[model samples]
Target: MTKLTGRLDDDRRTLVLTRQFDVPAEQLWTDFTDPDRLERWFGAWTGDPASGQVMLTMNAEAESVPAVPCRILHCDRPRRLSVTVTDSFGTWQLAIGFDEDEGSTRLTLRHEEVDLQTVPEVGPGWEWYLDRLTAAVAGEAPPTLEDFVDTYAPMGQDYAVMISGS
Candidate 1:
Protein backbone atom coordinates (compact mmCIF):
# COMPACT_ATOMS: atom_id res chain seq x y z
CA MET A 1 0.00 0.00 0.00
CA THR A 2 1.10 3.55 -0.65
CA LYS A 3 1.73 5.89 2.26
CA LEU A 4 -0.34 9.07 2.44
CA THR A 5 0.58 12.39 4.01
CA GLY A 6 -1.32 15.60 4.67
CA ARG A 7 -0.03 19.11 4.07
CA LEU A 8 -0.87 21.98 6.38
CA ASP A 9 -1.23 25.28 4.59
CA ASP A 10 -0.89 28.05 7.12
CA ASP A 11 -1.58 30.84 4.67
CA ARG A 12 -4.83 29.31 3.51
CA ARG A 13 -5.67 28.02 6.98
CA THR A 14 -6.41 24.61 5.47
CA LEU A 15 -5.18 21.13 6.10
CA VAL A 16 -4.89 19.40 2.75
CA LEU A 17 -4.73 15.64 2.51
CA THR A 18 -4.12 13.91 -0.78
CA ARG A 19 -4.35 10.23 -1.60
CA GLN A 20 -4.27 8.15 -4.74
CA PHE A 21 -6.55 5.15 -4.84
CA ASP A 22 -6.44 2.24 -7.23
CA VAL A 23 -10.21 2.28 -7.51
CA PRO A 24 -12.30 4.29 -9.91
CA ALA A 25 -13.81 7.62 -8.97
CA GLU A 26 -17.23 6.05 -8.67
CA GLN A 27 -16.02 3.57 -6.09
CA LEU A 28 -14.18 6.27 -4.18
CA TRP A 29 -17.26 8.45 -4.30
CA THR A 30 -19.41 5.68 -2.87
CA ASP A 31 -16.88 5.07 -0.09
CA PHE A 32 -17.14 8.74 0.82
CA THR A 33 -20.81 9.52 0.31
CA ASP A 34 -22.60 6.28 1.11
CA PRO A 35 -23.64 5.82 4.73
CA ASP A 36 -22.94 2.10 4.79
CA ARG A 37 -19.55 2.48 3.14
CA LEU A 38 -18.64 5.49 5.26
CA GLU A 39 -19.30 3.53 8.45
CA ARG A 40 -16.59 1.13 7.41
CA TRP A 41 -13.92 3.79 7.64
CA PHE A 42 -15.26 7.07 8.96
CA GLY A 43 -18.69 7.41 10.53
CA ALA A 44 -22.32 6.51 9.98
CA TRP A 45 -24.59 9.43 9.21
CA THR A 46 -28.35 9.76 9.50
CA GLY A 47 -30.65 12.19 7.73
CA ASP A 48 -30.01 13.29 4.15
CA PRO A 49 -26.32 13.76 3.49
CA ALA A 50 -26.91 14.43 -0.20
CA SER A 51 -29.12 17.48 0.23
CA GLY A 52 -29.55 18.65 3.78
CA GLN A 53 -28.37 18.35 7.37
CA VAL A 54 -27.20 15.06 8.84
CA MET A 55 -26.12 13.81 12.22
CA LEU A 56 -22.94 11.78 12.15
CA THR A 57 -22.07 9.31 14.82
CA MET A 58 -18.34 8.97 14.80
CA ASN A 59 -17.42 5.30 14.76
CA ALA A 60 -20.02 2.54 14.74
CA GLU A 61 -19.62 2.50 18.51
CA ALA A 62 -21.66 5.64 19.15
CA GLU A 63 -20.18 5.83 22.64
CA SER A 64 -16.86 6.89 21.23
CA VAL A 65 -18.04 10.42 20.41
CA PRO A 66 -21.17 12.45 20.41
CA ALA A 67 -23.13 12.85 17.19
CA VAL A 68 -22.10 15.88 15.19
CA PRO A 69 -24.46 17.91 13.07
CA CYS A 70 -23.26 18.74 9.60
CA ARG A 71 -24.84 20.75 6.83
CA ILE A 72 -24.21 19.77 3.28
CA LEU A 73 -22.80 22.74 1.44
CA HIS A 74 -22.34 21.17 -1.95
CA CYS A 75 -22.62 17.69 -3.37
CA ASP A 76 -21.48 17.11 -6.94
CA ARG A 77 -21.40 13.39 -7.34
CA PRO A 78 -18.07 11.68 -8.07
CA ARG A 79 -16.38 15.05 -8.12
CA ARG A 80 -16.72 17.27 -5.06
CA LEU A 81 -18.37 17.49 -1.67
CA SER A 82 -18.35 20.36 0.79
CA VAL A 83 -19.87 20.55 4.20
CA THR A 84 -19.93 22.54 7.39
CA VAL A 85 -19.76 20.39 10.50
CA THR A 86 -20.59 21.60 13.98
CA ASP A 87 -19.56 19.73 17.10
CA SER A 88 -18.57 20.47 20.67
CA PHE A 89 -15.48 22.32 19.52
CA GLY A 90 -16.85 24.54 16.76
CA THR A 91 -17.91 24.65 13.15
CA TRP A 92 -15.50 23.43 10.50
CA GLN A 93 -15.56 23.74 6.72
CA LEU A 94 -14.52 20.67 4.81
CA ALA A 95 -14.21 20.11 1.08
CA ILE A 96 -13.25 16.99 -0.80
CA GLY A 97 -12.28 16.82 -4.48
CA PHE A 98 -11.98 13.71 -6.58
CA ASP A 99 -10.16 13.52 -9.90
CA GLU A 100 -10.30 10.42 -12.00
CA ASP A 101 -7.29 9.21 -13.91
CA GLU A 102 -7.01 6.31 -16.32
CA GLY A 103 -7.81 3.56 -13.82
CA SER A 104 -7.43 5.35 -10.51
CA THR A 105 -8.65 8.33 -8.54
CA ARG A 106 -6.92 11.15 -6.75
CA LEU A 107 -8.68 12.39 -3.66
CA THR A 108 -7.94 15.65 -1.98
CA LEU A 109 -9.55 16.55 1.29
CA ARG A 110 -9.28 20.11 2.48
CA HIS A 111 -10.17 21.12 5.98
CA GLU A 112 -10.64 24.81 5.57
CA GLU A 113 -10.78 27.44 8.28
CA VAL A 114 -8.61 25.46 10.69
CA ASP A 115 -6.84 26.72 13.75
CA LEU A 116 -3.09 26.57 13.61
CA GLN A 117 -2.77 25.30 17.15
CA THR A 118 -4.90 22.22 16.54
CA VAL A 119 -2.98 21.01 13.52
CA PRO A 120 -1.03 18.52 15.61
CA GLU A 121 -4.17 16.79 16.78
CA VAL A 122 -6.30 17.17 13.67
CA GLY A 123 -3.70 16.19 11.09
CA PRO A 124 -2.89 12.80 12.53
CA GLY A 125 -6.51 11.94 13.10
CA TRP A 126 -7.21 12.59 9.42
CA GLU A 127 -4.20 10.51 8.49
CA TRP A 128 -5.49 7.62 10.55
CA TYR A 129 -8.94 7.94 9.05
CA LEU A 130 -7.55 8.03 5.53
CA ASP A 131 -5.52 4.95 6.25
CA ARG A 132 -8.67 3.26 7.44
CA LEU A 133 -10.34 4.25 4.20
CA THR A 134 -7.46 2.68 2.32
CA ALA A 135 -7.88 -0.51 4.25
CA ALA A 136 -11.58 -0.54 3.60
CA VAL A 137 -11.01 -0.13 -0.12
CA ALA A 138 -8.63 -3.06 -0.04
CA GLY A 139 -11.03 -5.25 1.98
CA GLU A 140 -8.73 -5.27 4.99
CA ALA A 141 -9.57 -4.74 8.61
CA PRO A 142 -9.33 -1.21 9.79
CA PRO A 143 -7.03 -0.42 12.67
CA THR A 144 -8.50 0.32 16.04
CA LEU A 145 -8.54 3.89 17.28
CA GLU A 146 -6.10 3.08 20.06
CA ASP A 147 -3.68 1.43 17.67
CA PHE A 148 -3.88 4.33 15.24
CA VAL A 149 -3.37 6.84 18.02
CA ASP A 150 -0.40 5.03 19.50
CA THR A 151 1.29 4.62 16.13
CA TYR A 152 0.59 8.08 14.72
CA ALA A 153 0.85 10.23 17.84
CA PRO A 154 4.51 10.90 17.23
CA MET A 155 3.72 12.14 13.73
CA GLY A 156 1.57 14.80 15.33
CA GLN A 157 4.66 16.46 16.74
CA ASP A 158 6.21 16.37 13.33
CA TYR A 159 3.10 18.03 11.91
CA ALA A 160 3.28 20.63 14.68
CA VAL A 161 6.88 21.41 13.90
CA MET A 162 6.19 21.60 10.21
CA ILE A 163 3.27 23.94 10.73
CA SER A 164 5.23 26.05 13.22
CA GLY A 165 8.18 26.38 10.93
CA SER A 166 6.06 27.34 7.96
Candidate 2:
Protein backbone atom coordinates (compact mmCIF):
# COMPACT_ATOMS: atom_id res chain seq x y z
CA MET A 1 0.00 0.00 0.00
CA THR A 2 1.12 3.60 -0.62
CA LYS A 3 1.77 6.02 2.20
CA LEU A 4 -0.68 8.79 3.07
CA THR A 5 0.03 12.20 4.53
CA GLY A 6 -1.98 14.95 6.14
CA ARG A 7 -1.57 18.54 7.16
CA LEU A 8 -3.33 21.59 8.53
CA ASP A 9 -3.56 24.19 5.82
CA ASP A 10 -4.83 27.54 7.03
CA ASP A 11 -6.42 25.70 9.93
CA ARG A 12 -8.27 23.33 7.63
CA ARG A 13 -7.39 19.66 7.76
CA THR A 14 -6.33 17.92 4.58
CA LEU A 15 -5.22 14.42 3.63
CA VAL A 16 -3.20 13.50 0.60
CA LEU A 17 -2.25 10.26 -1.13
CA THR A 18 -0.24 9.54 -4.23
CA ARG A 19 -0.19 6.54 -6.55
CA GLN A 20 2.09 5.97 -9.52
CA PHE A 21 0.91 4.24 -12.65
CA ASP A 22 3.10 2.96 -15.46
CA VAL A 23 0.99 4.73 -18.00
CA PRO A 24 0.89 8.11 -19.69
CA ALA A 25 -0.99 11.00 -18.16
CA GLU A 26 -3.37 11.04 -21.11
CA GLN A 27 -4.70 7.59 -20.26
CA LEU A 28 -5.14 8.46 -16.63
CA TRP A 29 -6.83 11.71 -17.57
CA THR A 30 -9.38 9.87 -19.62
CA ASP A 31 -9.93 7.40 -16.83
CA PHE A 32 -10.67 10.28 -14.49
CA THR A 33 -12.88 12.45 -16.70
CA ASP A 34 -14.85 10.05 -18.79
CA PRO A 35 -18.09 9.00 -17.15
CA ASP A 36 -18.02 5.51 -18.63
CA ARG A 37 -14.44 4.97 -17.52
CA LEU A 38 -15.07 6.41 -14.06
CA GLU A 39 -17.94 3.98 -13.54
CA ARG A 40 -15.49 1.11 -13.74
CA TRP A 41 -13.65 2.27 -10.64
CA PHE A 42 -15.12 5.32 -8.93
CA GLY A 43 -18.54 6.49 -9.97
CA ALA A 44 -20.51 7.63 -12.99
CA TRP A 45 -21.53 11.29 -13.21
CA THR A 46 -24.36 12.88 -15.08
CA GLY A 47 -24.93 16.41 -16.36
CA ASP A 48 -22.57 18.59 -18.32
CA PRO A 49 -19.39 19.36 -16.43
CA ALA A 50 -19.42 22.77 -18.07
CA SER A 51 -22.43 23.51 -15.95
CA GLY A 52 -20.08 23.37 -12.97
CA GLN A 53 -21.98 20.56 -11.29
CA VAL A 54 -22.84 16.91 -11.72
CA MET A 55 -24.63 14.14 -9.88
CA LEU A 56 -22.20 11.30 -9.19
CA THR A 57 -23.51 7.86 -8.43
CA MET A 58 -20.87 5.74 -6.74
CA ASN A 59 -21.27 2.22 -8.04
CA ALA A 60 -18.31 0.63 -6.30
CA GLU A 61 -19.75 0.86 -2.84
CA ALA A 62 -20.62 -2.37 -1.03
CA GLU A 63 -24.27 -1.36 -0.78
CA SER A 64 -26.60 0.94 -2.57
CA VAL A 65 -25.78 4.57 -1.93
CA PRO A 66 -27.44 7.77 -2.98
CA ALA A 67 -25.86 9.93 -5.63
CA VAL A 68 -24.07 13.05 -4.47
CA PRO A 69 -23.87 16.52 -5.89
CA CYS A 70 -20.40 17.48 -6.99
CA ARG A 71 -19.52 21.06 -7.81
CA ILE A 72 -16.56 21.53 -10.09
CA LEU A 73 -14.29 24.23 -8.77
CA HIS A 74 -11.57 23.99 -11.36
CA CYS A 75 -10.60 21.78 -14.29
CA ASP A 76 -7.28 22.12 -16.02
CA ARG A 77 -7.43 19.49 -18.70
CA PRO A 78 -5.10 16.52 -18.24
CA ARG A 79 -3.49 18.20 -15.29
CA ARG A 80 -5.67 19.02 -12.29
CA LEU A 81 -9.24 18.83 -11.10
CA SER A 82 -10.85 20.34 -8.03
CA VAL A 83 -14.34 19.66 -6.82
CA THR A 84 -16.51 19.87 -3.76
CA VAL A 85 -18.95 17.08 -3.06
CA THR A 86 -21.79 17.24 -0.54
CA ASP A 87 -23.34 14.02 0.66
CA SER A 88 -25.17 12.78 3.71
CA PHE A 89 -21.86 12.47 5.52
CA GLY A 90 -20.75 16.07 4.94
CA THR A 91 -19.02 18.32 2.45
CA TRP A 92 -15.76 17.13 0.93
CA GLN A 93 -13.34 19.31 -0.95
CA LEU A 94 -11.15 17.23 -3.21
CA ALA A 95 -8.23 18.12 -5.40
CA ILE A 96 -6.87 15.64 -7.91
CA GLY A 97 -3.55 16.16 -9.68
CA PHE A 98 -1.93 14.23 -12.51
CA ASP A 99 1.77 14.50 -13.20
CA GLU A 100 3.74 12.53 -15.77
CA ASP A 101 7.40 11.63 -15.62
CA GLU A 102 9.39 9.19 -17.74
CA GLY A 103 6.16 7.92 -19.31
CA SER A 104 4.69 7.11 -15.91
CA THR A 105 1.88 9.04 -14.30
CA ARG A 106 1.67 10.02 -10.65
CA LEU A 107 -1.81 10.72 -9.43
CA THR A 108 -2.26 12.79 -6.32
CA LEU A 109 -5.58 12.83 -4.52
CA ARG A 110 -6.02 15.45 -1.85
CA HIS A 111 -9.01 15.91 0.39
CA GLU A 112 -9.26 19.27 2.04
CA GLU A 113 -11.22 20.57 4.99
CA VAL A 114 -11.55 17.08 6.42
CA ASP A 115 -12.61 16.52 9.98
CA LEU A 116 -9.78 15.16 12.11
CA GLN A 117 -11.91 12.38 13.56
CA THR A 118 -12.95 11.11 10.15
CA VAL A 119 -9.44 10.58 8.83
CA PRO A 120 -9.19 6.93 9.85
CA GLU A 121 -12.13 5.71 7.87
CA VAL A 122 -11.83 8.34 5.13
CA GLY A 123 -8.18 7.64 4.52
CA PRO A 124 -8.62 3.93 3.85
CA GLY A 125 -11.72 4.55 1.77
CA TRP A 126 -9.77 6.71 -0.65
CA GLU A 127 -6.97 4.17 -0.80
CA TRP A 128 -9.46 1.44 -1.55
CA TYR A 129 -11.02 3.47 -4.34
CA LEU A 130 -7.65 4.30 -5.79
CA ASP A 131 -6.78 0.64 -5.78
CA ARG A 132 -9.97 0.06 -7.71
CA LEU A 133 -8.85 2.69 -10.18
CA THR A 134 -5.54 0.89 -10.51
CA ALA A 135 -7.30 -2.37 -11.19
CA ALA A 136 -9.55 -0.81 -13.79
CA VAL A 137 -6.58 0.75 -15.54
CA ALA A 138 -4.82 -2.61 -15.65
CA GLY A 139 -7.94 -4.45 -16.77
CA GLU A 140 -7.89 -6.54 -13.61
CA ALA A 141 -10.59 -7.34 -11.12
CA PRO A 142 -10.94 -4.78 -8.39
CA PRO A 143 -10.31 -5.79 -4.80
CA THR A 144 -13.36 -6.72 -2.76
CA LEU A 145 -14.69 -4.42 -0.06
CA GLU A 146 -14.43 -7.27 2.45
CA ASP A 147 -10.76 -7.58 1.75
CA PHE A 148 -10.23 -3.87 2.17
CA VAL A 149 -12.08 -3.76 5.48
CA ASP A 150 -10.21 -6.82 6.73
CA THR A 151 -6.81 -5.45 5.77
CA TYR A 152 -7.15 -1.73 6.42
CA ALA A 153 -9.69 -1.39 9.15
CA PRO A 154 -7.15 -2.09 11.83
CA MET A 155 -4.91 0.55 10.35
CA GLY A 156 -7.45 3.23 11.16
CA GLN A 157 -5.52 4.24 14.22
CA ASP A 158 -2.44 4.55 12.09
CA TYR A 159 -4.20 6.92 9.76
CA ALA A 160 -5.51 8.89 12.66
CA VAL A 161 -2.03 9.27 14.07
CA MET A 162 -0.51 10.10 10.70
CA ILE A 163 -3.05 12.85 10.12
CA SER A 164 -3.01 14.22 13.64
CA GLY A 165 0.80 14.07 13.80
CA SER A 166 0.64 12.72 17.33
On lDDT, the leading prediction is 2
Q: Which segments of candidate 2 are over 4 A away from where they belong?
A: 1-12
Residue-level lDDT of model 2, residues 1-166, one tens digit each, is 4444433455547778788999999899899889999999988999999999999999977799888999999999889999999999999999999999988999998898888889898887887888889999999998777858776565677887776667
Quote the lDDT for 9 in model 1.
Answer: 69
> In candidate 2, residue 100 scores what lDDT?
94
Q: After superposition, how far is residue 119 of candidate 1 from its true place, in Å?
A: 0.2
User: How far off is residue 42 in model 1, in Å?
Assistant: 0.9
Clashing pairs in 2: none
Can you write out model 1's per-residue Cα lDDT over 1-166, one digit (the tens) per residue?
Answer: 2233878665759999988998899999899878999999999889875468999888833268888898999989889999999998899899999999997999999999898888888888788888888889999998776766577656787788878775
The segments of candidate 1 whose C-alpha lies over 4 angstroms from its true place after superposition are 1-4, 60-63
Error of 2 at 93 (Å): 0.3
Error of 2 at 99 (Å): 0.6
